[model samples]
Target: MHNHGAVGLPLGFTLLRLILLGAVTVVAGWALVRPFVPAASGLLTRRVVTGFAGIGGVVVLLIAEATWMPSLAAVALIGLLAVPPALRGARPVLGKLVVAAAVLVTAAAGAWFSGPPSSFAYITLMAAFVGVSWLALCPPTAMVRVVGAALGVTLLAGLGQVTIAGQLTTPATGDPLLTRVALGPSPVDVLVVPHMPGWNIVHTTDTPLSVGNAPNALVPALPRDGTTGRWALVWLPEGRGELWLDRAGTRTTVPVDPGKVAWTGPDVRGPEGPDYASAVLAAKLTGKRGDLPWPALTDADAEALRGQVAAIGGPFTVLTDDSRRAAEAAEVVREEAARRGYAVTPGTSEVLVLGGTPPSGARHHLAPWLVPPDLTTPEARRYARTLSAAFPGAAPSRSGLAAWAG
Candidate 1:
């Protein structure tokens, strides 16, 4: 994950601050509320709003997947709020005492058994703390006010976990997995969407950019026939190391140690189908590819790139997510690749899998945006920094997200 923003503030520290602020707020609220509960008798009293509050709380608890403790606490608070005022007042002192003790026990149990996953432990624990604060704040007469806020905040904790779980399954906008692509927030990480005649910048605000989801992607306008263009999927399996991208349809085999670029053949399907096409295009790279790495570029190299792409011939699209400028630069790469004898087909993405570190003979390292994951150097980092400054985005906020869109 990328850290820091356009102004160079550490992203990680920002998240930590948010967590701390939530904790402080809950603690402060609890301290303020606890003093008003004069006696245990107050716990047994009910107010006018209890019925509606109890019904809502019970419904939410039943429908939600909150762990036992938050659920238990929410239910108890609702019940306390809903009971008839006289009936609650008539309850024996010992009975109220037992219920209070049970709640305390529930709190302890929640602390022990229902903690957040380690990856997001700090945020999860803060939610629990906030719920405990609510426990203290739920005065009998204002049951709806306090309990409602508490349950709402605590439910966010569960949502956080769900978001984390969804990370693996969510499909990026461009479906990088299919095209053998990578993504990050910075310009160095984002591919420029070659510009067309009437292109305009899409996302003007600086929300930390995920290249895969960035609105500026080289999305070819679908043809009138609606058929996906011909795609050349190729992968060079790492020496003696192989991974499988697909196990369905015609591509069920996994290579243990692939020796050369394995072509899945020319595919002509939209993003909707299974990985049968993508798997053919996939490569299992242990190290790097090609003899010489291209120098990473900073800022827009539009004119220079155009000169370079002049050799590659007409009507080509860039392999990028940037909706604004990917088309502009694709010709540079297209021409060069064609001049170099790599296949250049119309309406087809020409992909090459380059892995492993460059040999000592390599002189020019490619731009950070072009380099595959296995090959990143000091020069690449420098280029990335420069590119980021040129196209800055706001720090990302991934506190809550959901799954599934392919």
Candidate 2:
């Protein structure tokens, strides 16, 4: 059975398809027009070809399909495709003049549009004129064959040019994340923002951060040193700085009250998730690794801190709230140390306890009964007792815990 749940079109695939279809439309036009022109009457042929092309365009528009405009343009090209074949035997001199005039007019219009490579509509018009003029002006000179070849070449060039132009005109989904530049007294401080390469697949929401016009550029600027997979700048809070994370899920704006937060910037910045995602993916593909761990919470370096804790042994204090998870873990460690013959103090607010001094040349191991400064006397003492009970050999005291620290 076909699983509908698993069926989906990837964004990259969809985009590539659109591009290919656009190319196809331009390429196919010449072929469609070539065949019908040789057998049809001149006026009837032109009218029929142009009429069909116009109808095809209208149909594409009416359908409002994904590639409607491209489809229409392709259809319209078919008429131009026929110009050389149909004009081969016509009044050579007149056809040449007409074709030349058409070409000149199209060139003027193309200049007005400033088309890339050359403007699409104007290029197509010129291609048609060139083919027709060649056929009409040089009848004895393999006119049909020569103009037909020119038509094919011209259409191919026009197709390629238009395809590129379409690409340029279309909003880009994958581009490098632009580093936001902040003017500094000495030199511009440009913060490298992490761009998640494949993030555009999921997080499609475009906020001001995406547009680079966000008022709070900092919210989008995170100190990305490269370690963790690239981060996408999702939010930029002016003055407050920016927030970034890997783009994999949906994100909602934290709606702070209008008065609680201020928006100040050159312009309202829109979301930049797609661009950032693309960059990160590209970086990952290239095997580029960065130096810094991201977001700071799940830092790989945090593991190093664990070693420092292990070396300090029993005397190192742990202050915890009522949850007691930290305190409980400490008791387990202290018990393990005692079995190994290390002298350590384990303290909570209720009791200040001391174990025998460590072995000669041993690191200090003292557990002090410590609680947050603001805890009530009784609550502090209760916590101390909890740890003291866990450490039967040591004396737990509230003040000892406080004094143990430098």
Candidate 3:
């Protein structure tokens, strides 16, 4: 028997989330309506009211994404609409001010208990704060108003955090298991077996895995067989002290023999040397048969890559920069691979970096170690400094770059 583990929110939490979201939505709706409430001889004419209503409706939609800019805009618009009625003949009473402050404090405490504020909840709370402020500035209201305000404040406390926590805590359904494949070479294959579906196994390494670098390092896991799922294999490079695999947040070590696989091919060099070797090995693992091409030999190189794709017998991507030469090189490889009867697309993965712009994208099979471009230019260095000051500890690195792409 296999345990897939808990996969989604608990039934009670799911109900609670729905209820809280619904209450917040109700408060937002009230706030939206409160601004349009017609007053005798007020600044708002029918046409003006309709126009503001239409605009506010759109603002509400934008606040669903709850990005900072849109959220601020929504708050400003709500305040503008609420000001006239809230201010008319309203006295600055100490009791109302105290109540408003208390409501806000209670709402904030609720939100804190729910967890860290997500954008959606934060924005919702902001809008609610505006509404509560408007209420405080207005004349004393009825029992119904008191009840509504209390409920709104209560809902605000739990609204954003519960949803954020639920999303963060949800576990991936599929688990990965590794098995060693001791075939004829120094870089042997290790099969990655997925216990469930929807597993796009991308991150693997030959060293101890960390949250930072696991996504960037190359693992010996080459897909030797054309098949996926149960038949998938990872080619481990020879003489690596250890092999590490990471999926989602889980990490594991796969045991391997350190024996070297003899290489009879022409010597390849440069930063792209590992890329070339990995591409060829990947192709061979997928049962592709072709003559090895020398990297220095352009025609032979294209043919060799073509053979690799032909062996793999599936979709492939060519990672290139914005430069003309890089684009042309990518085109050459794409055309060559396509000629071998497989679809080859432009953009990262099965990567061959010619020059300019670091290789990135989901399908990249090799770790691309890169020097920060900020090291070379004054303007770039200044920008990097500014970014570091703003984000702190987020200075650019290969792993950070890959995670950024993701």
Candidate 4:
């Protein structure tokens, strides 16, 4: 079973966490109880300190997670220890509750204000805070008990269950209470041609591809330097071909008998091995290989984009509905246009791009490439109409004006 985010913690982070934890203990111990002499008196009074500690724990953890500072979260837990003693000097219960409520209010102030963090980080930090605060309370023995309990709970949480003899003591089940998800896979996309069968694998690189004039860029098939001979695969849906193998810089083409094939170079295998799943194959030869040409843009699409660019520089009055997001997007359009020799500048024709929200309410899922605001002015209406003409799918809005933002 693949437990999500079960990846081991990096050693550097682990060491840093230990140091932070030690600091929390020291701070909490020193700030709370100054040892010897007037020992912690009035157990009831000490209990009130717990309430203040709770308030500090919640607020500090929230702030730490929002900022991705785990060390700060640890410091916050230690600071909470001090908070209890400070509040204990007064009517602690009422004060603690007031502070806790204030913390909740602060958290609800939305992304613009409260800068939300990963829910898991927030939860973990809060748990650590609670444990440290508990340890800071009562006698010195409380540290041992609280720390042990905290470690056990944290370990079990990381493992996703309490197990006995490799079997779960408590049945594993999804909980509605746990809203935080673990770290997830990176964002990526690839095209898979359906019905085109055989061995399928995709390779990609982040290196920017150098493109040139025309609608496509041609890249020569130069095999990267690394010797382990290269193999060529040849066949189509109507399967009729063979496999060719090369070593070092020599070229050798051997006709494959149906499935029977053999290769020995980087892979040490005796004789021919059967390659049953290969629709089409080509190998990159040393200095002798085909050039790869990719369509940068279709002629029609290029013309349409060019036209759009030309429109931007002249009679277009671009109105960014959101100065924060749409303002940048509008600028991108202008830059791309300028790069293609369209050179758009601000003008009288009103073109408004509504960002942050679309008619569908989801700014991400359902919006098109571009979203124009409701056509109120004549210039906006004209711009929308032009877009509709340019893009057939760009049907006008209720007021019969078309605008798009992708």
TM-scores for the candidates: 0.28, 0.30, 0.24, 0.22
Please report the TM-score between candidate 1 and the true structure.
Answer: 0.28
Error of 2 at 37 (Å): 8.8
lDDT of 4: 0.31
lDDT of 3 by residue, 1-406 (tens): 1132412223433343354355456544453444344332233332233233333333333333233243345444454444434344444344554554455445444444422124345444444444443443444445325643563554345354434333222112222222332222222223222212222222222222231112345333332121121211233343212234443334433322222322333222222333233223332233332122323324544555455555556666655544433455566657766676667655534544445343555534321232233344564454445434332333344322222222
lDDT of 1 by residue, 13-128 (tens): 33433543453344434434444654432432232222223333333332222343465565565455344322433232334434644664455456445432221332233333
Q: Which candidate is the best by lDDT?
A: 3
**Cα-based lDDT for every prediction:** 0.30, 0.33, 0.37, 0.31
lDDT of 1: 0.30
Model 4 ranges off by over 4 Å? 1-12, 19-65, 68-82, 85-95, 108-117, 127-406
State each candidate's clash count.
33, 49, 11, 15
* Candidate 1, residue 378: how far the Cα is off, in Å: 23
- Model 4, 255-347: lDDT tens per residue? 111111211111111111101100001111111111122111234433444455554454343434433333445565566555765534344
Ranking by TM-score: 2, 1, 3, 4
Error of 3 at 253 (Å): 26
Name model 1 segments beyond 4 Å from true. 1-45, 48-64, 67-94, 103-111, 115-357, 365-368, 371-406
Question: RMSD of each candidate?
Answer: 18.0, 19.6, 20.8, 25.7
Identify the superior model by TM-score, candidate 1 or candidate 4.
1
Better of 2 and 3 by lDDT: 3
